[model samples]
Target: MRIRATVAAVSAALALSAFAVPAAHAAGSTLDVTFSSMKVNSGKAITVGATSTVKVKATYTLTHPSGVSVANVLSGPVLYRGTSAKDADTQVVSDAPGTCTTVSSTTLHCSATITLPASDLYNADAGTWKQGGVAVDAKSGVQKWQNDLGTIPVRRAAKLTADATPEPVKKGGTITVTGKLTRANWETGKYAGYATQPVKLQFRKKGSSTFTTVKTIKSSSTGALKTTVTASADGDFRYSFAGTSTTSAVSSAADFVDVQ
Candidate 1:
């Protein structure tokens, strides 16, 4: 649904001309252009929050025969969720052609931005996505696609909170810890409860820097968490989520408690 002008124009031409021709058959054609050193989002996971459009930068090296004039060529990187671009279930393409700088007589380094709108994405779309490159001759209508250049993880942003009751409690007394787990909902453009997920209760001593897991508990149907712990010492309590393929890992800020 986030298709851009360059992608739409090139895709239409490729469809009509059957642009899947292999590189070996591009002897005298503009399809001889090849892509290398392709990288998306600087090789980091792309995390999207509700309602915001995420733009990631992609860079690659393009090599072409000296005889081919690249002035008429449109090239950029794309992320897809299927075997190939033409057969992709969903794909994200750059809004414009890549800006290239000459590296040599036969090679150029290029970079472009791929925009992703949260409203256009589904929960199932969060996972490993294949990276590929596409090049099209604007005038000749010839195109070339290189699939499986690499992979990137696309995940929804997650959030967690923790609060411990009775800031100052007597030793051996019972303390209640409560929190919530939520994740970005692309469809509704909001942060919704992530129900029935396992979350960890962690404790860190006043003088220590490390937090040790005290227990693991599952969230309620509405993503609420509540547990009881014995107040033994002065420390901080927090919750942690390991995260799923569709969500990014997150931890809550620690709530400090004093034992009398």
Candidate 2:
């Protein structure tokens, strides 16, 4: 009787083990990349002229769904472009390194770095900046990473121009104007990738002598700045930012339509 009972117990234990489901992998969703700050000149793209330095840093968090190994590769070089057009108009900007560190069985951590070229950040390309955003090239190999929710969108809005639809304003009305500023990094200069001094924006009437001081804008963790101000009266308006020895170099005039 003892021998028979032992055999039946062993058989029942084996059967239960075979029927049980395997454990699921603890992978999370897609990767999440974000910038802490970014900056450029108030009017121009880069500060400190061609010799200026711009520092940019981003944090990347990778989430997985299963037990898949992600290749230790970084994101591509993104551009700081105007709002109007895309493609070739989009210049290739610098990026930081990307690496994966196992935060948990289902979570991973990584980073990206970018260094802007010298001349590209200094002068205006003589193009209408309708909008401003970032872009990147397709990864060299087949894409392994996919967006789980909406966490892994390709680009973020760095800066943007006012919309085509004009906002209503009373003639000679007091209205607020705001914008962000980002100084450029160096391509071929003494101080490269280091931030130039901050730039100051001065507002004025297009054809009039009257000028009013508006708020100053600075860069973000990604190297961009935004500012806003109110107008004393309505007319053709524009802004100018000249470089100080400690601040960014001169920037081209930016304009806005003031309506009655």
Candidate 3:
């Protein structure tokens, strides 16, 4: 899988530049700004799928000294996978600077978006990520970075499939259900099996809107699912995965079965 050129360039700049800003800045000038109330994706997990781009919204409060001119500053949110941006295993940044609304002479409420394309990420990138903010003085090139404002989960999107064999079966006969569980593999830009995860078998009567859990089973090493249920009535069957820290929950399309 190919990592986005933009991300690679930005990541390299983050490691080499001062305060994690893309641009080079003066050595000793202090931006003298503080970031607070940083909320990434509204404090929710970021779920990304294969071949799609995920845009995450972030909001924060920026405070600056009255002597500082906020008009010439460019600031935005940052997501990193290590202790700090300079040493991060991977990092993601907004394409544009954050837009801010002045709340007071010394405070501004800012919002920005960070885009994540599956091709730019690796499977190992899924997990807890630290949140941070960066401010750069457009005039003097002074920069400041605030790390560990909070943390958020970055998870891979999961998929489940369910199929019931024997469209029409005797009421007392056996019905076999099978499925596969898979999640986005950013390393390969494809969906791969998610093994050893618990998934639920659910059923709903033909006319019902709610599905009740029938049984629970663990996916095989290959993420394949197979089970047998005694046929009793006409209904729909599906597999449901509750999800985990690194994966998003998903349910398969309902497969209708007819009982004689």
Candidate 4:
């Protein structure tokens, strides 16, 4: 991480104009940030079911709204937004401060990434970095050069896992399976950078001999899938996630439905 301060790089004409006109102070120009690669590694992609150890790189280029360029530094806590779940938060980066290293007098570059978990998927957005001391509104003036982030969609190691809500649902009503197809970030393109396997939901009526396919669905970007089933006979139902080898067992021992 390079943190060196560069001289203000706005053009002489712009600087003169900024100095000549007091309103220029209030009319803060927009620093638009664009990315090159939002990947875990610079050029490589992590295969499904494998752990990713690459640091994500984002090549960012900043431009002013007025076209009169000025150089500025950006840093601080960067939050990567994922599906709405609380634990779904993937911290792409924690905290590291890097200043702008200008390519020319007018251009600059910088990068940062937070450690990612092995089972967790990765995806993030390029937004204005919030500097602690700077007011929220004023922070927009600073732009961190962005790289198109590379994602390491990690596949879960082959194993047996079960996901269900309420453990076993009430009989005569419904049972729900909160399923997820989790893998390491695999594939390519937009959604490929993250791991969210399409979920499979199978069920059989209570005491039924064979389990039947009730529904198949994919987890949200955050890896969440759910299914609800009603029991025909009071007993036990057997079902499992399709594709990968996984299963869940629930006993609907209660014979009657609870109308409430």
TM-score of each: 0.86, 0.32, 0.89, 0.29
Local error of candidate 3 at 158, Å?
Answer: 1.1
- Per-model CA lDDT versus the true structure: 0.84, 0.34, 0.83, 0.34
Positional deviation of 240 in candidate 1, in angstroms?
0.8
Error of 1 at 121 (Å): 1.0
Residues 1-260, model 1: lDDT tens digits: 64323335334323233333343454465467999999999999999998878999999999998876787777878788888853576777766678899978899999988878898788778899999888877666667778988999999999999999898999999989999999999878999999999999999999999999999999999999999999999999999999988899999999999999
| Residue pair clashes in candidate 1 | none
C-alpha lDDT of candidate 2 relative to the true structure: 0.34
Q: Residues 1-260, candidate 4, lDDT per residue (tens digit)?
A: 11111112111111121212122432544235433322233433223233443334433333234454453334322323343111123333322332345565444455544333333442221222211110011333433322223333323332223444444445466655553333333222222211354444555445466655666565567655556766444443323444332111122112222222
**Alpha-carbon error at 148 in model 4, in Å?**
7.8
The C-alpha stretches of model 4 lying farther than 4 A from their native spots are 1-33, 37-39, 46-59, 63-72, 75-91, 98-100, 118-152, 155-260
- In terms of lDDT, model 3 sits at 0.83
Candidate 3: residue 176 lDDT (0-100): 99
lDDT over C-alpha atoms for residue 75 of model 4: 34
Q: Evaluate model 1: give its lDDT.
A: 0.84
